[model samples]
Every structure is written in structure tokens, then in C-alpha cells.
Target: MVRTCFYDRISEKRIAAEALARQKLQEALDAPPAVIEPEPVAVVSLQPARNELTVAGLHLVMPQGFNFRDIDTTLEKHGHPVTFCAKRRPAPDELTLQRSVELYVENLRKNYPDVTIVRQSDRLLAGSPAIALDYIFTAGQERRHGRATSALINAVDGDERQWFSISTIINPAHAELADWLIEFDAMLDAIAAN
Candidate 1:
């Protein structure tokens, strides 16, 4: 599955510079002695919303008290190969998802010789974070899963892809936790493996 997300501060720096440059340009264009005041920088913070657990309709449904770090640990403990290494999603027009997928596959092969990589799809679901994560999970699983072992490539944005590999490497006694985790592991494996 392919998905896209944006950083809250993506445009902050660029916008500030642009505003200052515009102010200077206007000062030069205007009659002498025109006062040019810089505009205050706008600050945008990305506080995970209360509903952040569910993005774009995909419910992360992490266990109670679960968080990204906790999930990361769980996957690692289960022998699911994953890495939370990507920085941020890129703009659509910046680069194609195919390019990102290719890079991901190449890098994963170079860095992790023991694993396999597969591009799940070129398609992407453009929506909120929840939706994107959900698509990432489903698409990764559908295209890659084979005999309980598979690596998936899903687009996180036009320029970035999430990688992971899924397996029955886990053995948990708690049915509720295990069932939920197998699904989550698939998602993580898809992103982490790459």
C-alpha cells in the first residue's frame, strides 16, 4: 500500500525567507524611504491528534498504552525486520514513487544482504495519515506475502518508501496481542525490511 504525509514545518523556513525577500524586493521597487517590515514567522506544530491512532481510516489500533516506540520494540522482539529510518514524506511533484521504490530496494539490498525486496505498487492513496498507513499495510501484505515470509515496498510519499518483511518468527501466548501484532508486524515488516 502507498500513502503520503506532510511535515508541519515543511514550508516554515522557505516561507520565512520568501517573505523577507519579498519585503526587500518591494523596498527596492518603491519610492525612496519606504519602510519595509519583516513579517512574523508562522509556527506550525504537529501534535499527534487524539485520533492519531487512526489515520485515513486505517486504525493503527496499537494495544492499550502502545506507542510507536513500543510497537518498534515488539516488532524487533518478534524478529520482524523493520527500520524507522525515513525522515519525512516528499511533495508529489518532487519525485515519482517509482523512483523512491527503486532506491529503497537498492539501499536495502546493499545494507541488508540477507533479506529480499519487492515493490508492491506504484499507486498511492492520497488522504490523511491514518488512511495512508492503512493503505500501506494492506497493499504491502497483498503484493508481497508468500508462505508466511515476504518483503514489501510501499510508498510513504513521492520520494520516500517504507520497507518491511513479515514472517512467523513470533510466538506469543496472548491471543489478543498476538493476533493484533501479526497484522502490525506485517505493516512494520513491509516498512522495516526495506
Candidate 2:
């Protein structure tokens, strides 16, 4: 808990700097003076519609009171690995679902060379073929594992087909949150075609 009873105006410096940065960002967005790289998570404020969760046309019947957050890759530049990451990438029509899965897994291999996959499976998501992978890795002296779900969301846009992924890792210190894992699996199983 942070105490509000700190120093004088000097204590507000950090807050003021953050606010100024936000203002500058807004100004830049308004002017469109420079091109900004598209963020991985493009959707926002995923309001529940009819007790279902939808993002980028992918729908899921989320359970009551369950919570999930969209991952922000921008934070990775600030030294934060996206706790839950999701991304959509356009793929050629010739790419088979199995081939896409293989490509994604290969990219993960290049990124996390030390990771060891414990479980790998394929399933259907929203009526589209999908794959799930569970892997473990050592971070510092702590051993941690993560689960990821990938599905091909057919031609979400007019251009080409797209594939999406949702991956998350629970901090080893808070490993008791097994319920979160159960909810995630249930949600994945509840996916429906849009």
C-alpha cells in the first residue's frame, strides 16, 4: 500500500510526467505525424455481449464472474513479458492448419530455445482447427510453465486468412491459482463460430 502522505510537490513529479507523456501521445495520435507500429492486441474494452466474450470475431461463452485481460506487447519493451499474449497474423491460403501450427511452434522454439514442451494437442476452436501447447522453462532459478492455444480465424479481414493465439504463464510464487487454468480450458472448450 502506498502512503499518500509523502513529500510536497516533488512527490507528484512522477505522476505529472506520466500525464504529460499521455498528453503527448494523444497529440501524436490526433495529428498522425508519424506511423506507429500496429499493436498485437488491436481490440479494446471487450464488453460482454449476451454473456459471450468476443474479440476479432472469435466468440467464447465465458463463465460467470470470470476475468481475462488482453495482453499488451508494448510493455515488453519496458521489460515485462506479456503475461497473456494474443496476436493475429495473416497467412496464405495454401498454408494448411497443421503447417501453420508447425510454423508457430517453430517460431516459439527460436524465441525460447530453452523451453521444453510437456504437452501438445490439437482441437477445434470456434469450429476452426486449433492447437494447444504446454511447455516449461527455467527463469532465473525458478522453474515455470505456460500454456498456449492457437487457432486459425479464417479471413477475419477481406485480405487473407488469419491465425490467433492466446498464451499465459502463472508466476511460480502464485502457482496455487489452478482454478485460473481450469477456467481457461473451459473457456477454450466453449468457443463457438461467429
Candidate 3:
């Protein structure tokens, strides 16, 4: 359908610009969300560090005090061309919860063409609202794929308010625990602000 736009009486050019901007934004909002759900991988329990570990707004429950390794680094090291990776970022205090999550996913999509967005959603985490993004990516060196899940959580460092972006990835073929994927939610649920 053809639509007509009305501009302000003072400037037709300004009206056209505003209309164009609105159209672009509307198109983006109307675009289908890109969320890919790959076949589920087997899960295995990862040994937690004996003491609870905390980072970027997440308190990891590692009852056994097992040496802690970030999932992304482990993926980079586990084999050639196979990277099961996740990331944790200190969300700049300026961005709102949703914007931080969107920018993070958009950065991933822009930097890596192979990123497959598995899912994105919002949830209450640690008494604050959080956004979660689950996705998969292909490693060029090994021609292997890895699945990852990420969440953005709120925190406070003394009087300064802060936020964190937490993510995790796993190599399906090489993971140690059976049914390992199951614990991601539990872990996220356990996130506590320090």
C-alpha cells in the first residue's frame, strides 16, 4: 500500500528525513528475529571449583574447588579449529539492560558471519531483569561448530551501579559431562550481585 507522509509546515526536507528514518526503524523492528536452534547436544556436569567463584556479576557454584577455566578459552584450546566459547563483559554503566544485550549480539553478528543466533529472551536474574542470548558459531580452523549462551545481569560495586554480560559455549563432540547443557539455567539463576 502506498502511504503519504505529512511533514512539518516549516520544512519539507525535515519531514522527508524523519519519514525515512521512521521507515528504516520500522523495517528493522518488523524484520524476523534471527534465532537458530540447532539440535540439542548431550550434556555432562562440569566439575566446579571447590569454592564458589564469582565474576562479572555471576557467582559460580563450584562446590569442589576445581580449577576454573572460562569456557571460551577452553574451547580455543581443546582442539584445532574447534572453539566452544562464551564471554563475560563488563557492561558499560550507561546502556540499559536491553540495549546492552542488543549491542552485544549485533557486534557478534557483524564481526562473525558464521554466528547462528539460537535464541534471545529476557528473565529476572538476581532481582533484576536480564537478557539472554543463546547462539552457535563455526570455527574456521577445525570446521567445527560450538553452541553458546549469554546473559546480561545487573550488579552494584559499593555505591556504583554496574552490569555484566555472561556467556558460555560448549563443543558437543568433546564435552565431558553427560547432560551438561541442563545446568546453564541453574547457573544463571544462581547469579548474585556482589
Off by over 4 Å in 2: 1-70, 73-82, 156-159, 191-194
Candidate 2 residue 156 Cα shift, in angstroms, is: 5.0
lDDT per residue, candidate 3, 1-194, as tens digits? 76456554447777888999999999999999889997543222221223354566898776454543444443233342333344444445576776766777788778677887777776644445567676767655532333333333333223333444455555556655324455666765665433
Who wins the lDDT comparison? 2
All candidates: CA RMSD (Å): 22.9, 21.6, 17.8
| Model 3 stretches astray by more than 4 angstroms | 1-94, 141-158, 174-178
Using TM-score as the yardstick, the better of models 1 and 3 is 3
Q: TM-score per candidate, in order?
A: 0.27, 0.53, 0.46
**What lDDT does the true structure give each of the candidates?**
0.36, 0.64, 0.54
The per-residue C-alpha lDDT of model 3 at residue 171 equals 57
Instruction: For residues 1-194, write the lDDT of model 1, one tens digit per residue.
Output: 65334553557767888999999899888857767897543222221111134445787654555323212222343444322222233234444444444554465456444444322532212111111111112222232221122222234332433322222323233333345434653553333111
Winner on TM-score (1 vs 2): 2
What is the lDDT ranking, best to worst? Answer: 2, 3, 1
Candidate 2 displacement at residue 29 in angstroms: 70
